[model samples]
Target: MRRLTIWSIPIDREICAGDNLGDLLGATGELADGDVVCVSQKAVSKAEGRVIQSDPEHLDEAFEAALAAETRRVLRVRGTTRIVETHHGFVCANAGIDRSNAPAHALVLLPEDPDRSARRIRDRLRFAWNLHVGVIVTDTFGRAWREGVTDVAIGVAGVRAILDLRGTADWTGATLRVTEVCIADEIAAAANLVATKAAGTPFSVVRGIDPAWLAESSARAIVRDSARDLFR
Candidate 1:
């Protein structure tokens, strides 16, 4: 039988710009080799200074402007909500500009380069703790036609982004096809179980992942190419 364990790391200090996230997380003294560390996207954005100040009096206008600035193109619009493609090629609502978990009168933008951010944090952890572990930057996203949101990987490092099971055999000796799984997203969602949105927990650790899945990969690899995107 296989077992997995996940838990949240409580950080007493508030995350701010110029803070060394790797250091803050490592201070928890809970990380170990073969573990996958899930970090909140807001924390990464704040640490990387990917935040914008919105006018308290003109918040609506400022949000519109900021959304326009971050968006590469609009795909769909329903009332005040927009489904758009970000410059980073992510398709998300409102350009992924999150007002929740942000400072007053401010918005937290997605990291400029999430893959690079993941890599830097992984390197920092490796240097500090001498432990090789996977890192994932997570954000809450709503699924199409779904009623609620779930945390998903916006950045990944030292972990297999997807598990391709095509051409593999399923139970009862059936051949599988088109069965690729987004393991990173699954892991991120699992981490969110412990790191709740209202809990102010910005980090979580997942253990018991398959060792073979520990490798370099990016969250961008999970993005479907525009030409093959049937939803677009």
Candidate 2:
């Protein structure tokens, strides 16, 4: 049986804009093949300088303005909550604007291009360590009917975003009809368990990735196409 292990990498200092993630990870430990590097979108946002200011005193208008700037369209609204579609086609609350984690009066927008960010980090790690590893950047998100949130892959590189086993046979020799897996999101959720709140753990390593699952794909591949989307 195949087994996987996850462990958090404690980041001693808060990640700030212009900080080099490759340099930071290099100091952690030697990386190996098939190692999945899972990163929090919060940290990636800081590195990419995706921050804005909202007045602590007049938060209502300022927060709404920031949300408007980031949102491509408002999908739904209930009371003060808004579900929006971002330019990158992500549909989430407030276009993924985060307000709670940063220092006072600051808000963080999602990375400009999460897939590109993942590729950059993957390339840097490969160049420095000569190890072919996968990289996934994650963020917490609420599902359509789910009560709570779960971590999902907003960025991915050197990893399989989706695994289609639709035609494969089951253990009972029955043909599987529609069995597809979202590997990236699943891995991100698992990593989030370690990279939790009040822990300062922004990074995690998911070991024992199956070699067959190491193909390249972006996180967007998992997003439903606008044409085929039923909810929208």
TM-score on alpha carbons, each prediction: 0.96, 0.95
For candidate 1, which ten residues in a row score worst on lDDT? 195-204
TM-score, structure 1 vs. true: 0.96
lDDT, model 1, position 152: 92
Best by TM-score: 1
Q: Residue by residue across 1-232, what tens digits does model 1's lDDT show? A: 6689999998776789998888887878899999999999999999999888867987778888889999998999999889999988888899899886789989889999888888988999999878789999998887888889898999999999998999999988999989999999999999999985666788999999999999989998988888999987
Models, CA RMSD each = 1.2, 1.5
lDDT of each: 0.90, 0.88
Off by over 4 Å in 1: none
lDDT of 2: 0.88
lDDT of candidate 2 over 128-227, digit per residue (tens)? 8677889999998988987999999999999999999998999999999988899999999999888758878888999998989998899889888888
